[model samples]
Target: MFYNREIYKILPEKAEEFCDFFEQYIMPVQIKNGSKLVGKWLTESRDEVMVIWEYPSIEEYRKIIERVSNDQIGRKHQEQLKKNQPYLIKTEQFLTKRDKPERSNQNITVSGYIVNDVGEMLLVRTYWRSDTWELPGGGVEDGETLDHALCREIFEETGIIVKLFGITGVYSNGETIAIIFRGKRTGGELRTSEETKEVGFFPVDPVNLSTYVKRGKFIPRVLDAMNGQYIPYEAFQVRPYKLVKRYDGEI
Candidate 1:
C-alpha cells in the first residue's frame, strides 16, 4: 500500500473553486483506476487545499497515473491546470509507503534475477502491470521447491530456462513474502507468455532503473540482488531425511 498527498496553495477565497475544479477533472479518472481519496482539507484561513489519496500498491499507482496522463484524460487534466492558474499559487506533493503490520497467512512468491551473455538483464511487462517493467517471475505454487519454482516461473514468463545459482534476498510486506534468486540464462529463446506482454533483456543502468521500475518498493529489491552478497540455498526432504541439492552462489 502507498499514500499520495497534494498540497495546493491558492489565492485568498479560492479554495472551494479549486477543489471543485479538481473533483471534476482529476478525481474521477483516478477513482476509476482504483485510487481512493482519503480526504480533502482546507487551511484555517481557507487559502490552501490539501488532499490525500490511497492506492493498493505502488504498481497500481503507477498504472493509474499513466492512465490519467495519457490520451483524452491527460488533455483534460492539462486544461484544468490552465484554468486553475488564476487561483493557484503553488503546489507540492510526496509519495510514501504504508506502515507494514505483523504478518499472518502471508503469501509466498518467487522472482528470478537473470542476466544474459552480453550483460543485459531479463525483464517482463504484464498486461495488468502495464505501466512498468519488472523482473520475470511469479507466485510459488504448492508442492514446488523454491529453485524449481523460480526456474519454472522464469521459463513460463520469459521462455528462458535458467540455472539458478543462489538466493539473492528475502523480502516481506505485511501480506506477501518474496524470495529472489540470482542466476544466468542457460538455454531457450526469448518469447512472451500469455501473462507477459513484453519480454526481453535490457541494460541495467543505475541512473535509469527508475524508468523501468517506478515502484519504490521494487527498485531496492532489484538493486540488492544486482549488487549485494549471495547466500547459499538448499532443498531437502524431511521425511526421507535427504538433501536434494545445494547452490554455492556466485559473487
Candidate 2:
C-alpha cells in the first residue's frame, strides 16, 4: 500500500480547529476519491496533527489527486482551507510504500562482545543504569549496516577500536531481535563517553565477575564466544520497504 502521511504544524491552541476542519471538509472528499482514512492523531503537546491516507499504489494515489482536483466538493474544501490558513503554521507530506504487515513490527539491535588481550571482556555502565554493567551496544540506526552500527556503538560507549570476528548469535525476545557479534580489541585506551559512566575489561566468567556483570544479559553471549561457537550471519536484500531477498551468509 502507498501512504500519504500529512504532518501539520499548527498554532498550539488551534490544533482542535485544524482537526475539525480536516474531518468535516477534507476527509469526505479524499474518501470519495479512492483514499482510505487510515487515522488521525494529535501530538501530546497539542501543537501538531498527523493524518494518514492510504492507496493501493502510486498510480491510484495520482488518480485520487486528480479526482479531488476536479470535484466540486473538493474545490470548496480548498476554499475553506484558505480561510483557515492562519491556524496552520506549516504542512509536510511524505509518500511511502507500506511494508508487509508481518515484518513491519520487528525492531533490531546490535551488540559487540569485545575481549581484550588479557581475555577480559569489555563492559560499560550506561548513564541510565550506572549500577548494571552491560556490553557496549545500541539500536541500529536507519541506513546503517549491523556491523557498522555495532562498531559505532562500541566506540561511542567505550573509547576503543574493535575488529569484528563473526556473528556470535541472534536472540529474539517478543518483537525485538538482538544480533551479537564477537570482536577483539584492536586499539584505543579505556575511556567513557557521555552515555557511559564507566568502561573497562572484566573477567569473562560470571563466577569471577562482580554481581552486576554476572547478572547482566550479555553473559550468555560472552560464554558462547569463549567456546568458539558462532552463528552464520544472514544477508538480506531490502527492496523499497520490504525484504526482497534473504540468504545464509555474512550480512
Candidate 3:
C-alpha cells in the first residue's frame, strides 16, 4: 500500500531563502509527522523545486500534510515564504501501489534470468504489473514444457527469441513453483506486446530495482544467479516454510 507523490513548485528570485526554510522547518515537520521526503532537486535559477514523497498510505500522507499545514511553525514559515517569494506553484501529484500477485490453478511458473553478452541481466515492465519491474517471464501455459514456456515468455515480453541455456534455480513450496532459467538471446527483434510495456537489459545492481521488489523476497535468487552460483533443484523442493501467527491471533 505504499504511495508516492511528485510535487513541482515554481518560486521567485529568493529561492535560496525558500530552500533554507524548507530544509530547516518544513522537512523536519513532514518527517516528524511520518512523511518521507524521498527525493528533491532545485534549479540554479532558484525558481523551481521538485520533490518526491513516499508514504505507507494515502491516509497517512494526508495526516502528515495536515499536521504540517496546521503547525504554528509551519504557518510562520509559510508566511515568510509568502512575503519573500509568493510565486510558488504546485504542478502535479502521482500515487501508486504494489501490483496484485498473479494467481492460477496450475501452480508451475517458468521465469528467466536472461543475460546478455555484456553480462547484464534482463528485466521487464509488464502491462499486467504496471509501474513495477520484474524479471522477464511468466506462467507455464497449458501443454507447454518448462523450457518452451521460458522461451515463449521471453519472446512475448522482450521480443528476444532465446535458447534456454540451462536452469538457474527451481523454487517451490507446495502451492507455487518458480523455475528460473538462464539464456542467451538468440534471434528476434525487440518488440512489445499487450502484457509488456518495456524491456531491456540492466546491470546486476540496477539503480531502480526497489520499485518492483518491495521486500527482499526474490532478490537472493537473482543475486545467486548473477554470481554464477547455480541453485540446486532439490533445495527448492526441500525447504520447509510455514506461516506463523502473532500473539494477537492475527496473521
How high is each candidate's TM-score? 0.59, 0.52, 0.46
Determine the C-alpha RMSD for candidate 3 after optimal superposition of all C-alphas. 16.5
- By TM-score, the best candidate is 1
Clashing pairs in 1: none
The residue-by-residue lDDT of candidate 2 on 1-251, one tens digit each, is: 56788887788788777877887878877765556788988999998888888765566577678878876778998888778777775565756653534234455788887888887889888644456787888767556778888889898778899988678688886556888888789998888874676889987575665564645566676666566566655434555565433323232
- Model 2 TM-score, 2 decimals: 0.52
- Kindly give the stretch of ten consecutive residues in candidate 1 with the minimal lDDT sum: 97-106
lDDT of 1 by residue, 144-240 (tens): 8999988998998888999888888999986678899888999999998656779999998778999999778878889988885688888998986
Clashes of each: 0, 0, 0
lDDT of each: 0.78, 0.73, 0.64
Residue-wise C-alpha lDDT for candidate 3, range 88-117, written one tens digit per residue:
655656656436653343357778877777
Q: How close is candidate 3 to the true structure, as a TM-score?
A: 0.46
| Candidate 1 overall lDDT versus native | 0.78
Which whole-number lDDT from 0 to 100 does residue 188 have in model 3? 80
